[model samples]
Target: MASATVDSGGIGRASLFLASGTIVSRILGFVKLIVLAGMIGAYGDSADAFSIANQLPNTVYVIVAGGILTAVLVPQIVRASQHADGGTAYINKLLTLALLILTITTVVAVALAPLITGFIGLNLSSDQLALAIAFAYWCLPQMFFYGLYTLLGEVLNARKSFGPFTWVPVLNNVVAIAGLVVFAIMFGADPTGSRSAGEVTPAMVAVLAGSATLGVVAQALVLFYFWRRIGLRFRPDFHFRGVGLRATGRMAGWTFGMLLLTTGAGIAETQVATLATGQASVFVLATAWLIFMLPHSVITVSVATAYFTRMSEHAALAKFDLVKTDASSAIRGTTLLIVLASAVIAVCAYPFAAVFVSPFDQIVGIGNVILAFIVGLVPFCVLFVLQRTFYALGDTRTPFFFTLFQVVLILLGVLGCTQLPVEWIAVGIAGVITVSGVLQAALAAVLLRRRLGGLDGRRMLQSLVKYLTAAILPVLLGLSLVWLLGGTQQGGFAVSGRFGAIVSMIAVGLVMASSYFGMLLLMRSAELQAFLTPLRARLRR
Candidate 1:
């Protein structure tokens, strides 16, 4: 087995590598989204149908094994590594059991695809519902591959091999992009989602859904090469008895509950969005969500994941102080980036959103949603790190309770959203997400303090204050530039063509980022310095 011990700065280095991969993957993902937007306009039935169908598998995957594989498996694998056989037996058994569960779930889900599609797309028109069901038939099978990818990735993470997991998603995006390109060439762009079920061909369905499933299959299969390189061999072992299944079950119990509440809230949100403003609203919300997740996936997830294994090891060794120290560093690091990102996103929401959606109206809709969602980004990052800290400590119950409270708030928010004007429903949902994020962050902070005996509250608050202060000038500068260059337009830069829009966004984004970092440097922010130290050293080398 590989050495379980990591170097003192290993988490930071690992986070950098993971962050780099995420940056590349996100760039590709953005291109893929752009391609998708061109193929199916941001607000339409087809876009909504595909988004709903695609998202359902992820929701089901989370409800079933996502939490277990993510929160429960790593710590167990870490514990099992101490055995004479290097946890091979434990790994094999766990893999076998997960595969069995995933296979069964996928079969059942596919068989019930129509029923599931009806529930998710209950507000859709007959044509939209039929298309969604057709997509679900192909997309539902992705649950198995999603499970396989997570199971393999978690094992890699437990062994301190993080790159393969982060980098592999690029392939998934590439495959999807290629498929979309082909579809565009064949069927042309369907910006209005006006394509009827009768017009849809089997070849189109195969290219669309088949390519998606193929990408996941490739993602899961690529890990085997890495597993071999690391000297780990997979063997089919069904001896699930007395192999730590009980402990995993116990951990998974709380996690499953948490997932249930979270997925319930998501379903409610989707239903509200769809019911309030048709399928277009769902697509708008999804587009905004993808942008919202960019910073979280690149910075927060990378930092939290890199720190988690180390934190778990510290907990195992009873080094509570070290765990606290790691958590503090991760929180500070993540907050620094997310705060800045949130500011930039909020200030430049319209122009940035204009890059994705065509037509002035759709751009305005998406931009409004983006602005509302951006306010929650920092708090959302905080919640993410705190949850991982709890998971690292082998305490999933506390996070679940806090999450349940957040979900209840979200459901109430969704209900309130249903009362809004059709045009504003997406914005209302975004507001709900923002409010819930703040509440969740506050609750998680208080609970985590009790769990950790004190979470350095003064330091965290100071960091938040300093980062926000530094961000103010950059945000103002970005907004002023947008106003001067793009005018007070509602949708996007009053640019003529796609090329012009792309150029305008790039220029505006560069100025914002440069000014933001410059302000941080001028403020002599310790977090900024810490973040840049490795880059400086690499330059010197």
Candidate 2:
């Protein structure tokens, strides 16, 4: 049963499809990580150095063109196309501004990468430092290409054409992988090739690095073609030049401020990991992150696309009631999905972790220890979905403020926890991150309700109760089945002997998911209807 409140915007549908696309992208991204980790190994100082060295350049790209650009540009493009009356002209102005900013930023980033790397001194070996430097130079072109692609993607999204945007990463990964493959082939043929994979031969590293940058170029070109197909013209309009920069600058301030705070939180986590003995902290953090992002990729990113689209439409219509209803539905759907995903992760943590680190288990150890913190990832998933929903509503500042507060809490908690002599600082850091996320989500939810003129709190609570009932039964049954089948021990259950465990897990998951939907539908929960309708249609085939 749908809610009594009307939803004029197709938020529910958009979220579902968006999440599906995100899942595809995230899976490819995951595969990329696995391959990279296998190649780089896990525990060595060289790998550590590579991670740290790439961090700044990656940060520069994300802040200047990736996150900040996506967060700010999407809404503006939505407004300009949908409601600003100037329409195509407005979009052209936005694109021009984006180009100008990207050009300046890329030039600046390339110049700064070396000086910053030297100053930070991430304790890389001479070879590692050189590779890092090469990687930085290779990453520069991405700033320009990503900015263009992001603008085009945002335009497609605003026009409610998500199919093309969703597959853009497929193009990116294919190009990137091809480049890497070619670079490896070239390197392996070189006379100096036998000098260890980790040894950064300038020629080899430069080839790999340069190829990476070229991949981004390839990505942008594909997206540009799609943009043209969708009726976008690449006009370098200087019409709004002077004033446009100023407006963009103003928005950039807010965008960068939020990014800076979030980046600080990331840095804080890294620093804490650094304090731990060996790479245990990094391994755990990375493993937990991989698990955590699965749900986020599915739930949050999916919901964000729908939310952003609906909010843009609703803002145009001044349909506050519809806006509120759509927002509530997005939250409800995202929350329920996360709960389900958390249950799945909890059950499958060991197997999933094993697969992730299979090729490099020696370097990182068996990854099961990171499962301790996987539970804490539930709230983090919820927070990510909620934050994206808020941002989509053009209320980005609210999340910024809440994230700042959360970071404060994290800093204090981590600072205090480190003094306690825990062996796995990653676990302690996980606790802090979890706590911070929950706090932020709680605060944001309150603000969101206020913004929406109060959500159906009692109704939402009742739905949550039904969901909890549906979720718990399957989890318990699955756990019991796993325990009887030799538990989640790595060596105890051979894949041959443990077919029962796999079968039982599948059975339990299906049963639980079905039961959860049944309960929600029986309770007349709008969220259940929103989710199950599409699934039911697919199942009908």
Candidate 3:
């Protein structure tokens, strides 16, 4: 297939659109989290049950198709597009195959929802297990929708129509938030886990899990308009024997293996968290993960997605130098932003976490977890871009091997944490994630260097050091400011209300962020200037 035309403005503009969409989506997503936390406290049985059940579909989907759809689909679609029919036959057949798989998988999953829920919530009370099973009946069907959304979105991505894929999640979040609002109004706050399984009506289950699934369906279907605008029409093609699917199937073997390893680590982490008795359940760990992914989704993912297709095209054309350049720029840019973000988050971890959990104790619990997770933020972001580089080069096996190693490390780390107190279990999980990220990043860097002949390591490391150094003073100053403003070491701050907490976070955040950027400017950081150039140009206009 002919390569999709690269935007002349390069990754900057593409990243901007993706980043903007992600910013809005993340903001709304956080709002949804806050509402859900209010409706059901983060650590309670209901919260854990609902979280595990709701996430089960995603887990199953990833185990089955997520990695392939993400790591293998774009390049396959790009190759298929070179066909005489503009890849239409291949795409239709692939889509048909995906839909068939999703339908079958969803049905089987929904039927086994109770057993799945039981496994995920092994540590939950029988009532919690039953509630989770009920929720699963409504939520498990989301697997099909999730697959649909990914298929549509990746096709758009291959066509270089990126905005819809990034922005559609906003609709999902909005619908979910609306449902949460209604659930809160109807049931009031159920944060105490006081409601038994008998009290949760079928209508309640439909409202909660059904509404969530509705959001996924809407997110998937809304892409059809964009699909039409791109001049692509979907036609079901059942004759899949001769399309390029054989190659994709070959690639998917390794991709699926990689996901299995990653998912195994996730399950291990969840199980370990479940053993906890206090505020360290899987829900709490998941919330912290949400927070950890905020900067990543907005920055690392945006830049990586923007560059992936171009890089793939370059690799396809044997332009190894261009591929190297793109990978280097993305890594450096993502590292700088994520490092800064990690510093800011670490300093404000307490108040930031306080936004999601009410009551002082829960605040401290989630806050500590956030801090622990922050340690891995930079490594995780770096590894994200590097993995995409591998995907673009059509080398899924390397990542699989590296990830298998990382998962081994993660399992070891989590097992070692089994002796910690319940409240500290979340911290242990965070630690495991951080350790795995570091190891994964290191190994990915090594492999990427070999693949590219060399990856400008000296330059990248220099930037990393400078950024880390620049972040230190700002973080210390922010901590001091927070301390002076009645923030406790335990993650709570003196605030009149949520509004007060927001005010404090913004005020402190601005001052800290300014300090970080100011230092970067003073140090004459080239990457910082490159980052600011687009904004500067827009402002000059």
Candidate 4:
């Protein structure tokens, strides 16, 4: 039997599920942005209004919505499922509490929207401000439903019912896209004809807001349907007097602490970025954020989903060896993924810039300059996966402390970068942050290893060498391709028109992916075999 491992069973299955969901969500999110960009156009008061209003609600979403969904609720569901609770009671109680919290938060948010926009969004015009308030109200209400949806998802994941969970985000994105199309029709045009009346007012920024609300409603309904199909039944239990209250309070307390730290660091980064001279430079920062977050979305969340489930499975079966092996595999897998991605990005970076940067030049001329810094962070970004490893071992404080330290380093780095030219500032910050990330990961690995007690260090190091060797070949090939293809000259891949950058990026991405795969095959790395075996099984299916 080769000693059945968590990697071979539920956790692996759940990870693939979450990964697939994330891919779907990311693709749809990309589409949604494209639609939004076309509808709003670039560089105007409307765009500014949408951006500011959206950020306000999103910040709340992250702090409140995401805090519970990822940290508190998911862990609780996993624990409940481990003891053969099958998730019903835990799901009901968590959802009930989440609804209560979300409703209260939404009310407070709506009332305070104007105040928030006034303080944080001081740059917007009157129309922009009105739109922001409307959008905030529309989207704010979703916090309640999504809180329940998140609970359902966590329960499904804990139950190893990942297929359902995976499809939910895709469904959510679909609704969002649909709403965008309708909003465009209703709003009439960017100048105001495209507005659909009740669909979303073009004159109001709430069109974007309405789309978000509709999407959440649709997503929540679908999740609820699936929850029912999965045999989950819930009754409201609002009394916070005993076990439920204690559990909810503890989870919320932990999650809020963690969320505050994370959100505070993000806010600091933005503040520092804003202090830079050029206005367009902020777009550069935003674009960098968009690009880096693609991988962060796919890798970090997928691994966390897997880690949490695997930990529960191991605890249930009393299979310590399997647990350790699965944990080690996860660490190695995520680390290699980060390394390979960084290498590829670093190698073909200039070509990618030529293919993707020019179009955004109108809003951001220093796009290519920022791309370098974005690539620089890839090395450190892998450490994000370390948080999953810690969480799996029932530790979260390590991540909190490590994150705080990194934030301090980032603040210092940004302050130092301001002394340099604007062009170098982004790069300098990226370099400092990346290096700090590496240090953080090293320290985390040390601490985690000591706490958990076993991690195939010797094999891990050997695998790293093999992985690096395999990665080097493609990087070399990619560099040659870029050099041969004009190497950052004015317009080798064509920079004009609506589809030029899109086509070029697609072509380059495909070539890079193919070449990287071929190189891995030639090396016959063990990691390649692991990926292939699972894929082969899926093919048989």
Candidate 1 lDDT (Cα, 0 to 1):
0.84
Q: Per-prediction TM-score, please? A: 0.96, 0.83, 0.96, 0.83
Mind giving the per-residue lDDT tens digits that candidate 1 earns over 194-287? 6665677767777888888888888888888888868888898998997788888898899999999999999988888887544338878888
Task: Pull out the clashing pairs in model 2.
Answer: 19-302
Error of 4 at 171 (Å): 2.8
Question: Once superposed on the true structure, which residue ranges of model 1 sit more than 4 Å away at CA?
Answer: 1-6, 276-280, 490-497
Query: Highest lDDT, which number?
Result: 3
Better of 3 and 4 by TM-score: 3
Off by over 4 Å in 3: 1-8, 196-198, 489-496
Query: Residue 535: error of model 1 in Å?
Result: 3.2
Candidate 3 lDDT, tens digit per residue, 1-541? 1122346456887887888899999999999888888877787777777888889989999988888899988887777777898888888899999899989999999999888877767777787788889999999989999999999999899888889999999999999999988898887887655566667777788888888899999999998888888788999989989887888888889999999888878887877888874466787888889999999999999999989988877877788888898999999988888987898788777777678765677777888899999999999998988999899888898999999999999999999888987789889889888988898899999999999999988999999999999988988888888787666644335332466568777878898789989999999999999879878898999
Cand. 4 TM to true fold: 0.83
**What order do candidates take by lDDT, descending?**
3, 1, 2, 4
Q: What are the lDDT scores of the predictions, listed in order?
A: 0.84, 0.62, 0.85, 0.60
**Residues 203-277, candidate 2, lDDT per residue (tens digit)?**
765665565567667767777776667667778877885334455456667767877777767766666665552
